[model samples]
Target: MMGGSAYENVGKKWDLGVEEQEWFHGLLPRVEAERLLIEDGDFLIDDDNSILEMVNQYCLSGRPWLDNSDIVLKNPIFREKWLLQNDDIILDRKLGKGYFGDVNKGIYKPMGNAVAVKTCKETFTQEQTKTLLTEGRILKQYAHPNIVRLIGIAAQRQPVLIVMEFVEGGDLLNHLKKQQKPFTSQQLIKMCDDIASGMAYLESKNCVHKELAARNCLVGNGLVVKVSDFGLSRDKVVHTMSDKNKPIPWKWSAPEVLLNGK
Candidate 1:
């Protein structure tokens, strides 16, 4: 509620810009705001108008929000439980090759759980590594039965790895292509239902999957389908496309995305 000429003068005295003064709670001191942001996701606008996410201790601006709490409330942020120790993971065999590097089947020793490990190749471009990390961050905040879960990420050393829940059936595209017999109507309906459920969950959290296709969905035991790849996902409901040159899956994309590039 800090606005108007009087507060603007105070903001100037504090060396805060005009934009900062718009949302700046000038009357609230840092100590009091810190005291208020005690719970997880608890935040306050500082005198600088930057959002102080106390639990994560990050100053964010422009469309920043707390993680999806509807799925799992008060859980540890990305750097906490989501950062895995490299020694705890033991890679078994190569599952497939991915965009940045190889995907391997592995065991997470701590929980004795089978996991899918995605590594960043040494020769990867900066954009590739960033996409991998970005996917990890997006996946870490979600929890749904029809969405693949992110176990954690091992990024302390080279060949950064993304560990995820392992699904035995693999990608839906290959499964569909390999099917010897056509699926029954009920089975096809179930698969579509599962995909819808996962996408619904993401929508509830205000996330948009920029690229969703059969190749990005995984089939689990009992023919359960789960939404997987999130390299192009965005947390915002509306995404602004800055690069029209970036390639998109023309065949799989919606007409609006193909026409508007967003």
Candidate 2:
């Protein structure tokens, strides 16, 4: 690992040969450097300013480094802080089920609080595991009232678990369906406004909620709505869905997204 002493010489311009530049690039955090290389083949190690510019552009673009196998292998600092022991969580009952796995109501021992634990399926592959970790990282960065908060992740367990704040009222769609009376216009407007505000925050962060609907939103106390289900979400200034084989939510998708495949 590159030490603090190495970074101290960052401003100094040295005559770096092709071999030396390649070696220096290899010393960087694999995921970050590799992602930038994927976007632009040039490493831009000619000068400190060029390297800074490349990183700045990457951050401005808001493209998430979701597939960082090396980072995963290294067990990054964030992972160490967020990873929970298997014994720390006690599952209570099933809350809901999805394509990837089931979510359950649980109690986190460390905090002595109720939490919603979403676990991966037993038959998950390496890609699925990486995606789960990516979601955890995304949630960790976002701190808004209208967005569901992620407590931590149980990475060492058999079925990797995602611990999130337990929204007592449950999903907005189910809450609406179960209600005997329809919501008043004012109440309906408030809910819509809440969702819009959440999306606005996400947009500001250069993130896109590809799947935004009542079903994916959660209702908290006082009927406050918070957006959830980020499995299909992307943190990019301009995201194009290249996987044509995957099914799209046609009803919720825009015309451009459907036609242009974005």
Candidate 3:
């Protein structure tokens, strides 16, 4: 937790007025905010003023702001706190590649644990970088055993990396297709249940996974399945597509989403 002196310095550095400080305190209870502030090794209270302004506005409106649009737009601060030093991660082997990035198996020096490091293409446009950061922000907010957990992001360097828990069993589709032995109906039912439970949790949080398929799900030891990929997920029920929106994979997308482009 931040010391009283450090808290006072933050208020002074941001030039927060009495009411603004009170509102900021209310938005993130002092204890919780302080704990996060102290835990983050690269904490920089001066990096983003827009986040402070957004929090102040939400506090004035007397509404919860953590999951709101305003907060989402100004999520750099959240991403900053979770930023991992690139030097600390050692990339081992390529896991897979996607349109935006490639995933690699790696070792996180700090925790001495295996992790997946997803690196964006070096030629990514500014908008693509923002989208990648947005995914990092979303993962930071949602933490569940059934969902792939984001460890941190290595954004200070090129080909920005998103580190996450590594699932040894790999994706579900391949796991099913390459079964060494025939599985019982009960095992298949349990896998379905795991997917449904994860989706149910997302629904309760007012989040849409957008992409839900066997290929996007990962399996762990003891056949634990976890939902992965949040590049297209949204916190709201309806998402507005841009003119440059990529064509949906019809096989994995909902009929209405494909028809109406929601």
Best candidate, TM-score-wise? 3
For lDDT, the strongest prediction is 1
Between candidates 1 and 2, the one scoring higher on lDDT is 1
lDDT of 3 by residue, 158-238 (tens): 667889999999999999999999889989888888888888887788777767889899999889899998776766653
Q: Candidate 1 on 6-54: residue-level lDDT in tens? A: 2223222224332222333332334435655456443334333343233
Q: Residue-pair clashes per candidate, as listed?
A: 0, 0, 0
**Model 1 segments beyond 4 Å from truth?**
1-79, 125-127, 237-242, 254-256
Local accuracy by lDDT, each model: 0.69, 0.68, 0.68
Over the stretch 1-262, how does candidate 2's per-residue lDDT look in tens digits? Answer: 3233222333422354322232132112245345544322233232223454334334334333256522211111112345566568999999989766999999999999999999889799867766676777677788899999888877553577889999999999899999999899999999999999998998788777777878999999888999998887765654457689999997876455667676
TM-score, every prediction? 0.66, 0.68, 0.69
All-Cα superposition RMSD per candidate: 13.8, 12.6, 10.7
User: In candidate 1, residue 160 scores what lDDT?
Assistant: 75
Error of 1 at 27 (Å): 37
**Candidate 2 global Cα RMSD:** 12.6
Q: Scored by Cα lDDT, where does model 3 land? A: 0.68
Q: Which stretches of candidate 3 lie over 4 Å from their true place?
A: 1-81, 237-239
